[model samples]
Target: MVTIKDIAKELNLSYSTVSLALNASPMVSKTTMRRVKEAAREMGYKPNAMARALVLKRSGIIGIIVPDITNPFFSSVAFGAEQAAHKRGYNLLICNTEWNDELESHHLTLIVEKKIDGLLIASVNKKNHLLEGIIKQDLPLVFISSAYPSARCNFVGIDAEPGGYLVGKHLTDLGHREIAFVGGKFNSFSVQRRYAGFIKALADQKIAFNKEYTLSGEFSIESGYENGIKLLKKFPKVTATMAADDLIAVGMLKAMLERGIRVPQDFSIVGFDDIFIASLPGIELTTVFQEKKLMGELAMNILLDELNSGGDSKREKKSIVLSPRLVIRNTTAPPHSE
Candidate 1:
């Protein structure tokens, strides 16, 4: 509760002199600055962030919006952003949208109202008009794990097509022709790119893709579990499957195991984003590693660069696409003859 006025009264110094000394302004004598700092420490004076932000024209706060915090992949991305922002004396305000577009838009509006220094959003949809509007306003914004090519804004995401292609090639290499894809919403750019790459790999192997075998839902364990059961029961001949993400893969794996299916013996599963759960002793899910945390770190770095540019008219737009690597684990293997 201690203010500069209290310090000025206690030290019998002019309010202007005390303010200059507290801020280490060169206009104040070094001795005066030292004394003012000492008094501040003794009086338990804490600087007001809002007051400081008003003077600097920046909040020193960054806002990050994710589809779902319960998903480990998104959580890792947030953690990376937080760490990077903290190192530079900035704090992060995390907002979870639960994969709803309405919530995402609402959160974006709230963040803008707060006058955040910058923003990092893992968009709920592929093409967002709201995001485009924000970009047009020249806000320092970065997309994490997703991007819209037409927007020409800052984005940090993984090479999803290549990651999907890797999974498709791996499955085909293991002699899995009767395959299926259980993924998130088909409208999602990440899902579309991954499916495109996967289909290309299948075409390379001269295998025709069956639209009936493709399933789409939210990128959640529940959706994965439900679709997985449906796929296994309906197709019966499928020997392997590729999941859009680790959560989906784990869900499908659980569903299969619960039905007394032997993984890698009766069926093979591959997932994306090698989340922590995928590496557990019993799971060991084969997946494509997408550098989840690094994606977040890179997105925050891009935002930081834009924020520090100080409203330069020639500010450069940046996009970072990280490569994906396949991690062979216990979940994938050559198909066995029935």
Candidate 2:
């Protein structure tokens, strides 16, 4: 509750002098600056960030929007952004959209109203018009884990196609000729790129790709469990599966376990986004590792660069794609010799 006026009164200094001293402006003598800081500490004075933002025209608070925080992958992304922002003397406001367009819009509106410094996001959908408004406002925006290519904005994401291709290569190398893909929504670019890569890898190995085996749904464990029934029934000949995410792979394991199908012996599985659960002692899911933290950190760095650019910051748009690596675990193995 202590304000600069209180410190000025105690120090018998002008309000402007106190303000400059508190900010460590070189205009104020170092001795005066030290005394003002001491007075501030003694009076328990705290700078009003909002008031500072008003005068400076920057909130020093970045906003982040993610589809689902419950997903470990998103959580990791948030962590990375928070750490990166904090290290740069900034704060974060995270909004969860729960995979709903309405919520995403509302959150974006709120960010604009609050005059947020910048935005980092893994948006709700591909056709997100919400970004256009933010851009028009001249607020810096960065995309993480997803990209809106048409917008020509800064983006940091993984090379999902290569990751998917790697998964396919791993499965094919293990003699998983009768294979299919499970999980992911129909329209997600991440899912499509991954699936495309998988198919490309399959074709490179001279293996046939079957479109019927690909299934679409929310990228959640429950969706994975529900789709397992249909996938198992329709693709009975499938000896292996490449799940769109670790959650799906884990859910598939749960469904198959209930059906008495042992993994790697009866069926092998591969997943993307090597979430923490994938490495649990019993799970040990074979999945691709995307640098979740790096995606967030780079996104924030790019946004800050733009924000600091003031008027002349219209640099060439940037698109950074982080690499994905295959992490072989307990779930994948060569098909059993018949």
Candidate 3:
């Protein structure tokens, strides 16, 4: 029931001055701003978000779409984004697509309808038609963790190819000549880049890259378990393997253990994304450390910058790629000798 008009009347200030002070406009003196804010708070005044959005033409809300929030990696990224958004006086509208393309498209359409100021997506597909349309509409969009290769937009993530190379080099250095790669969807941008880096590392060491040793599936523990089983049956001679993400790595580890294979003694495993669950007491998985929270913060910050720029057509697109480091844990070690 409290309104800015009431606060302005109580403070004996003009409507415009009170409004500017409430907005924290630099034009208002800091002393006056503080006074107005204190009075407003004491009067139990609350902002009318709908009216404010109508006036400013912005919702002060950022939309984020991720494949799966259940996955610790994406959840961590979302947490970082939420913190960043809160610091800017903005709220987040999060959507989980469950790694489904249709759900992703549906969420995009629904979010645009909600009049969000900006969008961030860890997309399921490398290129989406609906996303292309959204880009042409000039909405501020940023890619987090995943990217659309054909779109000219802002993106923030780790340099995945090098991350894969690190795993490959680490395994090879430990005398793992017959290593395999088990990853997510083969078409996804992250998977492709990681696979490329793995191959490059093998070539550098003059180790033959065997297509038979590669397996691609969904970025889930279930999929990882399935592929892990397949890998064991098809090529039991392999000494080590790398997974696309921590979830997949954990899944693969389970399959190996269930089959009575001792980790690091029978086979070594490396994963991407040093998620929280990866560092558990028994499952200390070796993985590439992606600054998950940092990635989210950087992505949100980029979106804020673009929003502040007022949709400048001349503004250059941004691509922030962070470096990746390998975190050696209990899951990986030198190949075993009978």
Candidate 4:
């Protein structure tokens, strides 16, 4: 609880002189600055962040709002963001929405009320009006994963359609005709883009799209497990399945294994986002790799640039769309060759 007043008393200097010395003001002599710093360090004196923020109008804190922290994809993104924030001498406040719009709004309000320097949001829905309000306020906000094309805000996301197309093309090249798509809720742009790409690829190859083979639900392992069971029972002739994410693929894989269906022999699976567990000995998931860490780092850098620039110029909002790569593994093969 030591304050600048305590440091001034210990050094026999006035409070104004101590404040100028601690702040490295040009008026303070070098010798006085050194003595003040030494005394403050010795006494464990720390400036109040609230007072500093009030004076500067910036908390030096960035807020990140994501849909689900339990998902490994978001966790990786958070790690990269934290690393970049720390490197630039800033702190991060992460809020998990659990795909709830109300909670997301609450977190956004709190972050704005706290006067954070910037915001990094991965919204639950693409067309959220709440995000529009934030943009209208001229907040330094960056959208990740889900974004509206009409919004005049900075966004960093991947070309999900092309990535999904790649998955479908890979499967088709491997002679998978009866392909199924396991995706998250239909409202997500990521899911929709991936599905569109998959459908496009299939149509190009003269493979007819079947409604019975498609399934959608929450992007969770349990949802994947339940959907996998339903898809397998309903479409026993399905040869290949492209999952929207690694978690869904893993869940489906577990269900297939439990049902005594050998992967790549009975069914081929392709997943998106090459998570850490995707390459495990048992899983060996053949999937699309989205460079999530790089995305997070770039988002932070963009926010910092905007904050430092003081919103003076109308910088062209950047829409970075990273390309996804296909990681070949043991999970995918020519359908029913075994």
On TM-score, the leading prediction is: 3
**Which digits, one per residue and each the tens of the lDDT, describe model 4 over residues 110-192?**
87688788889865555667767777778787888767767777888888999899999999999988889999888888888
**What are the clashing pairs of model 2?**
none
Clashes of 3: 0
What is the lDDT for 95 in model 3? Answer: 94
Residue-pair clashes per candidate, as listed? 0, 0, 0, 0
- lDDT values, one for every candidate: 0.86, 0.85, 0.87, 0.84
- Give the Cα RMSD of candidate 2: 5.0
TM-score of each: 0.85, 0.85, 0.88, 0.84
Question: Model 1's lDDT to the true fold?
Answer: 0.86
TM-score of 3: 0.88
Per-residue lDDT for 44 in model 2?
Answer: 96
Across residues 1-338, which tens digit of lDDT does each residue of candidate 3 receive? Answer: 98878988999999888877775555678899899989988988877778877776889899999988998888888999999987656799999999888898899889879889888887656566777778888888899876777768899998789999999999998989999999888887888888889999999999998899989888899999998899999998998999998889999999999999989789999999999889999899999999999889999988877776576756798999999999999988888888
Q: Which structure is stronger by TM-score: 2 or 3?
A: 3
Give the top-scoring candidate (lDDT): 3
- State the number of backbone clashes in model 1: 0
Q: Which RMSD values do the candidates have, in order?
A: 6.0, 5.0, 3.4, 5.8
Off by over 4 Å in 3: 1-47
> After superposition on all CA atoms, how large is the RMSD of candidate 4?
5.8
